[model samples]
Target chain A: MDRSNAMPTVLHAPISPADIAPFKIGDVVYISGVLYTARDKAHDRMLADPHLPFSLQDACIYHSGPLIVKEGDTYRVVSAGPTTSARMNAQTPSIVKQGVTAIIGKGGMSQEVARSFAGRCMYLAFTGGCGMLAREKIVEVLDVYYAELGATEAVWKLKVLNFGPLLVAIDSRGDSIYETVRARSHERLLRLIAERKRAL
Target chain B: MPSHREAFILHVAQALQEAETRLPRDVTRALANAAKVESNDRAKEQICTILENVKLAGAAGLPMCQDTGVPIFFVEIGREANIDFGLKEALATAVQRATDAVPLRKHAVYPLTRRSCDEPLFDMICDVSEGNRLSVAVLVKGAGSENVSALAMLEPLQDVRPFVLNTIWESGGKPCPPIIVGLGIGSTFDGCARLAKRTLLRSLEEDQSPFEAEILEQINELGIGPMGLGGDTTALRVFVEEAPCHTAMLPVAVAVQCWADRKARFSIKL
Candidate 1:
């Protein structure tokens, strides 16, 4: 697969669970068209309310709260950084089951989310703190889903180009870079300590 | 006092903006240095690319990375200053300006509502004392590092060594290694949290206390290295902050890792 020619892949909102199951680890997806941007609160509301503002099938939720600067009739994104995705550990599995095909955010997802969404959805870990660079990918902000949620938490419909240099940290196969690194580090530390103790 | 207040706020704000614009300078530098020394080519290359990207962003006036984190102010007020100026309000205003001018990413979220501010400015956690001289430290911590922050409460009689090692090991490359470890001992949970933040204020070359300096040396020996890619430079720096605590409880909060430990400071006289 030639990565450079991988034009953005667009998926509509309200994606189904089955739709999310097929995406592999390295595939670069550009979720343009439509999707809701919800963080902790929005997630809670969706969990509580039977009817949400929009459906979740075939959907991709981005863990971001962008800073939007308004000009004339339109708003421009000044800084749209990816928030810490680990904070959404509790909510991701449910959201994934609810038809979230992919998640774009900084950092890695939890073990539970990866296990729950095994071979179903992939987590794209975009570089955190590169809001300006990330903004370049967004061609235009189509609509703001929840104005009341404020800029950081508002759901934004965006049109994106190559939008990402995102990495496949957590894949549909239930593999996670975070878990692997952590476990290996722990093992290495333990071995070093034991060796030191024996030498002493 | 008035002159001092004005000077302090303006200087602090300027320092913060400069810090943001530079974006992870020390971290980028440290990562590049680590890459040179690292044995793993893949990890070294990754670190190199990350450093290059950060440099490019700085040159282009783009954010070093995306998560322009919550602006945390670690302030130390001296015992003899008399000023009527509202520091908090001034800070808010400065932050608002910085958000627009430097164009920092908004990061604050309304706790109860879970609603985030489209243009967040002030998420001030102030520390006050009785003096005329004030020292302020600003650390714009990105979410990547913040995600790896951990706290451990140990028994008064138990040693803190194991807990520290475990936390860092667990953190792994998650915090973007070759990280800075901020250890806070003896304070209450909240106090420990503040201590951890305060620890980041120290220069990468400075150590707050002797014990802390020793612990830092030990931690770097872990070999977590830059980007957790592995090397001798596991930690670029380690700062420890301690306070008095209860007899029965020895609260040790280890802010395990911060990838881009971006910090700047200013002093004011009133």
Candidate 2:
């Protein structure tokens, strides 16, 4: 836990199984290189469409709805930050199976999602709602897919640099920080209610 | 003529951008206080990150959150307002202008078809007021919190506190704590939702009712902390708005709001 000695890991895409293996639950990471943006709608589309324009192998997917502007013919990222990943739970396990090595989002996923890690995938959460911070880390947006799915839910191929302080909420071995906190909080909630008796 | 339409459009656009990028004074103060009180290291770290993010977003002139949320307008129109132009059209135009100006994510989708809306997009709620002045408040609420907001019709004798607690517990980290829980007790089921949603517009500096204060204390004690990581700041504030209900029903609505809590308001005289 010594901050001065332990430098954070900086990951670049296409991230390999080996590149992410050293990360565990609670290790903070910074990601650079090629990352993809896909939320609920894009997830569904990618799962259904066999002819996905981009490959999913070793891909790092970010759940984001970037505020982007079109300047002449190019797109500029104005704000890029993570969205809640819990909503994508149903599709996440399958997406991981498709060889996604890392998933970046805010809020953690479920037990089922943790199970999908299978010692080969990890879930990284950035500062929720910190779009400006995230956007600054994004160096360029390479290409966009499914542009029709509205801005938030579309697929964005982005080139990033040091895209973190990403806390590893779920690690490759199927361990989850969320579940740990949930159990602890639930116990506290009960004790607090019992002490107060909800009398007021 | 003060060019009401044009001025109002500009006002709305500015408000939208401000709401998207900035946390209101009361919200920031609440967060600062929360950080001071949080004992859990992880929870404190999360709160600090949020505060730091706010500063970074402001410096960069970018949205504080990537979701940018669904832009919702609460419009209060005066009784003697002379409306030579269409208010709805003007508001819509304002939304488009803000969309391009703020560069808000075009996330609107047709409910049934899931197809996207092409132009400046946002939702609005209109209410009539007594004066000749027009006031509009804009709130940028992200889906993370919206997805957890719920309405329930409980038995007349059932206590509302249990249901509210359960909602927060079940939501866990999904709504992006530390969040504000806006409770609407009494009124019809749908009306309760409206009440709860409206309560979010109130400033955190407003006087807290006794019930609200008690709930706030207990919610923090739940130790959901910031981002549900376990701490004493699970919720920064609890706001309750109530209305009369029928003789045999107890309706409750919980509107979960994320820490972003971005809001901006404008009042203009016609």
Candidate with top DockQ is 2
lDDT (0 to 1) per candidate: 0.67, 0.85
Q: Which predicted model would earn the best lDDT?
A: 2
User: Taking the tens digit of each residue's C-alpha lDDT, what string does model 1 give over B133-207?
Assistant: 777778887666766677767778776777778777766556766678888888687788778777776666553
lDDT of 2 by residue, A1-200 (tens): 66547887888888988888877787878888999999989999999998989999999999887878789999998888788888899999999999999999888899999998887799998867888888878898899999878667789999999888888889999888889888887886677666656564
Cα displacement (Å) at residue B192, model 2: 1.4
Docking class of 1: acceptable
Over B174-250, each residue of candidate 2 has an lDDT whose tens digit, in order, gives 88899998999998978898789889999998999999999888777667767655678888889999899998999
TM-score for all models, in order of appearance = 0.78, 0.94
- Give interface RMSD for all predictions: 3.4, 1.6
> Could you report the DockQ of all the candidates, in the order they appear?
0.27, 0.69
Judge candidate 2 at residue A10 and give its lDDT.
89
- Tens-place lDDT per residue, model 1, A58-166, is 6767777776767899988665656667778898888878777778775566789889876667787665555666676677887776566556666776666665556
- Quote the positional error of residue A36 for candidate 2 in Å: 1.0
RMSD of each: 4.8, 2.0
